[model samples]
Target: MMMNKMREIYGVVNMILFPEDEDPEMLSLELFSSFAKAKERSEEIIKEFIDDYGEDYIEHVTKKNPVAVMGNGDVTGYVYIVKTHAL
Candidate 1:
């Protein structure tokens, strides 16, 4: 379910995981800083746009990762998701 705006995305629906999961901790995004930093980064990006193209051209865009990790310690497969942009 990819989306388009400024870029192409592999997600829009099921922003977490599909079919859910047995353990809530497995797919939870508590440890990820990207989601937490999104708002702050968007503010900075918006400011940049506002400065260049004016406020009207600026849009409040948000980004997120939907991957998840399951298991414990080394056995836990940690799928790293990275956001190329962050303020």
Candidate 2:
């Protein structure tokens, strides 16, 4: 079978093209807040995740918009929730 290779590039990436079988899914929770507050909450969530899991599981860059925050379509910052378990 052919393997899917991942590459890192600079600038904004529109999509993640990881294969499903190769990329196992994990449970996560994300909280969105204003740009001014995103980092604070991200740090808090990271601490909580470490307390519960005994380690860090934040897959992407912290305090960045890894996923779109969909609500009223307003552009807001996000804090990605990390955990140790998969569901």
Candidate 3:
């Protein structure tokens, strides 16, 4: 049998890819935010999007957006969420 070269479909992404010690299906490169903090951020950021755009802003932008990052996370580089139908 011949060996094929492995490809980095996600590219040289700086963030941790999925199938990790935690959630294997998808590696969450985002820093864990407290409930209150998340709520505040949602209000500050998404509220504006909803007002400027519409209530469907989150639904439209998040559906298969393939990324979730935080400016405060260690994933301080070009982070990317790899797409996969399998685990």
Candidate 4:
């Protein structure tokens, strides 16, 4: 008998701001097998946004969703950090 193994996947969600548009663009930027790497990438993105627009213009959002099963039978639930304009 063989047992199935479960693993966690980490991802970053980016909200790109447009000066001319009222709505920001949202998308998944990257995926990682380790949370540390995902978090580092999120920080990098935040820093870039701050460097370009200033801290007052950037907002951080976090969301946690329920676990989802992929088509290949891999289960994943993401806790993502998003960068967007300050509201």
Candidate 5:
């Protein structure tokens, strides 16, 4: 038998770094279970990025989303999610 599961909260980090005239290099990192966890990880990522690429290059945003995921142990499902304003 299948049952509905509680919606999961996820945090996403998006970043773009490059000169205006050049192509933007963007990275999307996801898979965190909570906003705090996501933010914490993003901070670490930001530090590393800044150290390697410099603070001047980064355009950063953290997106918090609540996702309704449907599935069974067999792995068939759909994900419905909404994105909240960036922080």
Candidate 6:
């Protein structure tokens, strides 16, 4: 008898925008099969920001696992973001 193996799913990439005076906003970018892919996408977003702003406005880009508390929460599987100012 052959046993079936389960496929692992990696986290997602997100882009977060922080305005100078307004509230911050988040957008779900994409889901990747591996962390490497997710990281790459995150970097790409950062580069895009630099290109647009002519400077590095990013605060941080991180990979995080979302946890559920009593099944009541805004659960985003794996969220990554490039925190920047003024957009």
Best by TM-score: 4
Candidate 5 lDDT by residue in tens digits, 1-87 = 122121111111222232243322221222323566978997998699679766655532222333445466454544334333555
Indicate whether candidate 2 or candidate 4 has the larger TM-score.
4
Clashing residue pairs in candidate 6 (N, C-alpha, C atoms within 3 angstroms): none
* Reference-based lDDT, residue 31, model 2: 23
Local accuracy of candidate 1 as per-residue lDDT tens digits, 4-72? 322222231333455453443333433344666887897888687678666543332222343556665
Can you list the residue pairs that collide in candidate 2?
A: none
- Poorly placed runs, candidate 5 (over 4 Å): 1-33, 59-87
Q: TM per model?
A: 0.29, 0.28, 0.30, 0.31, 0.29, 0.29
CA RMSD (A), model 6: 17.0
lDDT of 2: 0.44
Q: How many backbone clashes does candidate 4 have?
A: 0
* Residue-level lDDT tens digits of model 6 in 14-52: 122323333222112123235669788979986887787
TM-score for candidate 5, please give it.
0.29
Query: Would you list the clashing residue pairs of candidate 1?
Result: none
Measured over all alpha carbons after superposition, the RMSD of each candidate to the real structure, in angstroms, is 15.3, 16.9, 16.9, 17.8, 20.4, 17.0
What is the C-alpha lDDT profile of model 3 across 1-87, one tens digit per residue?
122112223321322453334542223223323556787986898578678668775565556445545577555444334243443
Ranking 3 against 5 by lDDT, winner: 3
Q: Candidate 2 lDDT, tens digit per residue, 26-75?
A: 11111222543888887998688678656533444344445656667875
Q: Which portions of model 1 show Cα errors greater than 4 Å?
A: 1-32, 59-87
Weakest 10 consecutive residues, lDDT, candidate 5?
4-13
Instruction: Report the lDDT of model 5 for residue 57.
Output: 50
